[model samples]
Structures are given as structure tokens and as C-alpha cells.
Target: MAEIVLDKVTKRYADGALAVSDVNIEIADGEFVILVGPSGCGKSTTLNMIAGLEDITGGELRIGGVRMNEKAPKDRDIAMVFQSYALYPHMTVRENMAFPLRLAKVDNATVTRKVEEAAAILDLKAHLDRKPANLSGGQRQRVAMGRAIVRSPKAFLMDEPLSNLDAKLRGQMRTSVSRLQKQLGTTTVYVTHDQTEAMTLGDRVVVLRGGLVQQIGAPQFLYDHPANLFVAGFIGAPAMNFLPATLENGSLSTPLGTVALTDRVRRAAEAADAPREVIMGVRPEHFEDASLVDAAALDRGASFDAQVEVLESMGAEKFAYFSVEGGEAHASDLADLAADAGSAGVPDTGSQVVTRLSAASAVAEGQPAKFWFDTDKVQLFDPASGANLTYSAD
Candidate 1:
């Protein structure tokens, strides 16, 4: 396996419309790196550039320390697994996996041995004689993977390889893919728009938006300390709830009421030279039912009474949605987020907030419930630039 690096790489269409800006990423040998974003966010374009499927307009593309801008895709020594399982219906599983080896003019015995080994690894030995039409969606995907594995290329590029499967199968396949990558130790660059996939897989995640690189870090790092409003809104499930608040004298005047900032939060704000008008971001998991909080814990946070609009009890935990008095906070960077959250199927009035509460808490729908959120856990963002004013490297 070899490391792959994109140094200030850019891609502009023939029409001069920039599809990807000056972006840099380094994928170490045997590292699984993920490229993730909303649809049409230049993730695919970036992947294609690395795969030699698209031309690089600026900067350098290197694999194994060699510049590869002008190299044809076949010479890149990388295998790409696409979102669609592009399998040949006429070819059996074994034949499909052996096709690459045959094309390389390897001896028959070596081809057979390689195909058998790949089939064993993918657990497709039993279905070697079966055609693509006879296999399940997951199995077909594995066949595609087996085809790539037999090549034993220097690196692998997977473009949303599991998007076609059902949720349950996707979960199963995710485990399979991770384990397979670990076993092979091939450098991998996977592109996906799903945050769940981005969080679960990859040693490092590169978040992109509007053809620009947002933040690159471990999934939890991005979740805990997003660099900007877009990254904050895009990384987590249920998305981080955002509200407009005014900061003054180490305190915040929010829709939830006046909140006294903790020392850590205050320092972050001061270090950023935080503006009076800032956006407050709190993850759903950060909120708790006030009734369930201990006395010491309650003392450290602020409480507000909210009428639960919808309560979903998930057994171990509960999600409580409330409608705050003020409307949604809008940011140019979060324009897509607001649009997505406000889709027709999901009502996002900009007034709604989601809180995760302990399942034991006594909270019901359409009834007022006291909720508490940790003051130290709050993050402040500049509405104009979408920068996280209250960000701390720690």
C-alpha cells in the first residue's frame, strides 16, 4: 500500500465553473480516509480527480511520492468501487473476480488461485458459479469488492459503495467493508454523503461543502469542536440545534432566557472576540430532563420550560422536540442545512429544538417540560462568517 496526497488540488469544468477549490488532504499508507458532504458538494469530483477520472486544474496529485496528474486512470494502481454495483450479468462470481487477472494476462493457475482467495475472503465461495442476477444486493456488492481485491492494487477508491443496500444490509456491509479493509491494509479513500458512514468508518474524515474543504479530523473531533457553522450543522445526527442569542457581560440572552456562561465557555468567547449577536449550538444529546438531573449537575447548567411538541421514546433514551418562541436562525453557510431540515417531510420552522432525555424521565407530548443544558457544552458561532467563535483546540 502507498500513501495518497492531494496538495492544493483543484478541478474546474471546461466551462470554467469551479467544481472543487484549492483543497489538500494526505492519506497515509493503509489509512482509511473518508470524503463526506451533502449532495453536489464536490466529494465525487474530488474522488474522481484522485482516481484520474477527472483532470486536475491546479496543484499536484501524488501517490507513493510520484506526481500523477497526466497519468491515465489504468496506471494509477487504484481500484474504484462505485455506488452502483457495475457487475456483468453474464459472468459468474468466480469469472467476474478473475476478469481483471485475465486482462493482465496472468497465468491460468495464478488467476484461479487469486479468484479463489478473494472469494474466500468475501465469503462468496459457495456462490462462485452463480451469476450476478442470482445474488442479493449485498452479495453483488461483495462480488464487486472481490473483483477489486483480486487486483491487489496499491489503493482503493470507493464511491458510496453501499448506498444501494437496505438499512439493515448497509449496517452489515459496513462491518464487512471495515473488516475487509483492515485485513487487506490497502490505502482507501471512500466518498459518501451519509454522516453515519462518515462517523463509523475512516481514520480521518474530510468534510466538504460548496466545492470547498470545511474541516478535516477524526469524526468525534469534528462533532465535538466543528470549525464553522456548516461543519457543526452537518456532522451530527439530529443535527446540532442552533438558536440566535446575544452575548453580553459573560452572559447570553437567548430564547430559553438569560444564561450565565461557564468559565470555559466564557474564555472561548473572549479568545474569539465574540460578537454580541452570536449563534448558540447545542447537540440534542447535550440536553436532559431537568427532573433527572442531580442537584450538583443542575447547579452547573441553565433550565428552561418548553412545551414538548413531539416526544419519541426510544427505550434507552427519548427525543423531545419543542417549539421555541423565536424563529430559526439563518446563516449563509448553513443555507443548505436550513433548506434540508425544512424539507416538506420534516417540519423545520426554525423554532423547533430537539433534546435527548433519559427514558426514565416523565415527559409527554404537548405538555410543558423542564429541560437543562450544560453551559460549558454550548458553542458560539458568528452568523456572518459562520466561524465558530467559541472554538477551543482543547
Candidate 2:
């Protein structure tokens, strides 16, 4: 296995349009690092650069501590599995898996041993003689993986390898791939636009946008403590709720009402080097019915009132959309809405605040509902800069 490092790396097309800029990251040996972002956000370009498929316009790329700027893909000691499952139509699964070893001129016995080991790991032993056309979509993806596994390269580069499978198959393959990676313990760099895939498959996720690194941390770290509005808005399922609020005295006054800033939240804001009007972000599962919610168990913050505008039943749980009581509601960042939440609208003249509510009780539309967001669960950001104001206790 090898550690991959990109130091101030950049990629610019021949037309001089910058696809990536001063991107620096390090992937440790045996680490599964995921590159996640929206389409056309330079994720694939970054991966291709590491795979030696694209030229680096600036900075250095080091694989196993060796500079690889001018190296060809074949010389990099790496294997790449793409989204399309590029298997040979005429080749049987065994031939496909053994093709790399054959090209390297390995003897027949060694080829058979390696191919059989990979097939056993991937549960493809029964399908070894079958052609790609005869395999199911999920099976074909496994064959693609099996081919990469037999290489035993220094690192593996996978670009959205499961995108072609159906949802159920995708879930199954996700677990399988994660297990296989642990067993092999190879350095891996996976690129994808799906947040679910990034969260489930990565040891550490590198969130990217506009060719810039947003944040790099474990999935839960990014979810619980986002660095900015972009990371906050991009990491979650339903996304964090952002409401306009003003900071006056030691309290944050919003349309929902005034929330007393505890010593912890205040200290964090002071450390961020900003004390201006702020944006309040709350996650969906953070809000519970104030009447029934346990304050002592939560032990961090205050509560607010909301008027229910819409309630969506998601079987096991429910999401409530309601309006805050004060000032008009508007979203300054479109990326937040485009990432997860639907959209912000001026219904009932901006008295509606939409939030995800638990399914423990029935909440009806157009009803005045009392909801409580755990104080510690709230995220604060500078309205001007969109930078998160949470200070890590580190």
C-alpha cells in the first residue's frame, strides 16, 4: 500500500480554464478517502490527476513518496474502476480478472491462484467462465471490482463504481465493497457525487466544491460540526435549517424568537473573530415536541414556537414545515436548498418555518405547533461570510 499526497496541485485545461486550483490533500496508506461533490465540481478531474490520466498544471503529486508528475498510468502502480464497468465483452470473468497479470507476463499457476482468490473474495467463483453480457448489473460491477482486486496495486482509484446499480443493489454492494477494502487494506481514493455513498464508504471524506477543498474529516465530524454554510448545508440528508437572526446583547433574536446564548455558544462565536448578525442552522432530527421533549436529557439549549405549514410522513418518522414568528424568512445561500432542502418560499407572508418533526405525534398542516430544537444541536454562522462559528473543544 502507498500514501498519496497532492501538494498545491492544480489542473487547467488547454483553453486555460481552471478545473482545480491549489488543491492539497494527503491520503494515508490503507485509508479509504472519498472525494465528494456535485457534478462538474472538479472531483473527477482531481481523481484523474492522481491516476496519471490528466496532467497536473501546477504543484506536485507524490505516490508512495515518489513524484509522479510525468509518469504514465501504467507506471503508477495503481488500478482504477470506473462507473461504466468497462469489462471486455468477449473475455470471460476469469480472463478479465487475469488480464492484468497476463500482461505483466506472470506464469500460469500464479495467474490461476490470484484470479481464484479474487473471485472467492468477491463471490464470483461460480461466474468465472461467464462473459460480461451474461452477468447481472450488480454481478458485472463485482467483476469490475474483482479485476481491480487481482492487480494488488499500490492503490485503487474508483470513480462512482456503483452508480449503474439499482438502489437495493447499490446498498448491498456498498457493504460488500467496504468489507473488501478492510480485508485488503489498500489505499483507496473514491470519487462520487452521492453523499450517501461518501458517508458509508469513506474512512475520511473530502468535501469539495468549485475545485476547492471544503472540509476533510470523518463523516460524523462533518455532519455534527460543519466548518461553514457550504459544508453544513451539503453534509446532511434533509440539510440544516438556516434562519436569519440578529445578535444583540448576549442573545440571538430570530424570527422564531430570542434564544439566550449560553457561555459555550458565546465563547465559540467570540473565537470565530466575528460578532455580527448571524444565521441559525438546525438539523432535522434536532427538533422535538417541546411539550414532550426532555430538556434535562438534552441539557444544552432553549425552545421556540412554530406554525405548521406542511407535515410529510416518512413512515417511521415525520418532517414538519412551519414558520417562525418574527422577521421574513429568506435563504441567502442557494447551495443549501439545492443540496438537500426543497426551497424557501414566501407563504403566509413569511410566517412559515419548515422543520423536520418526529413521528411520535400527529402534526397537521396550518396548525400552530410548539417545537423545540436542542440548543447544542443549533449551528451558528456569520450571515456576511457564511462561516460556521462553532469552536471545537480541542
The C-alpha TM-scores of every prediction are: 0.97, 0.92
Candidate 2 per-residue lDDT, tens place, 176-195, comes to 98999999999999998888
Give all candidate RMSDs, comma-separated. 1.4, 2.6
Instruction: Put down candidate 1 lDDT per residue, 1-394, tens digits, no spaces.
Output: 7999999999989998998999999999999999998888899999999999999999999999999999999888898898997888899998999988887899999999999999999999999999999999999999999999999999999999999999999999999999999999999999998999999999999999989999999988999999999999999988898999999998999999899999988988898888899999999988999999999999899999999999999999999999887766778877877665556346566567999989898999989989999988999999999999978777
> Model 2: which residue pairs collide?
255-326, 321-354, 322-352, 322-353, 322-354, 323-352, 323-353
Model 1: colliding residue pairs:
328-350
Clashes of each: 1, 7
| Per-candidate local distance difference test | 0.92, 0.83
In terms of TM-score, how similar is model 2 to the real structure? 0.92
When summed lDDT is taken over every stretch of 10 residues in candidate 2, the lowest stretch is 339-348
Name the weakest run of 10 consecutive residues (lDDT summed) in model 1: 338-347
For candidate 1, the per-residue lDDT at 198 reads 97
Cα-lDDT of candidate 1: 0.92
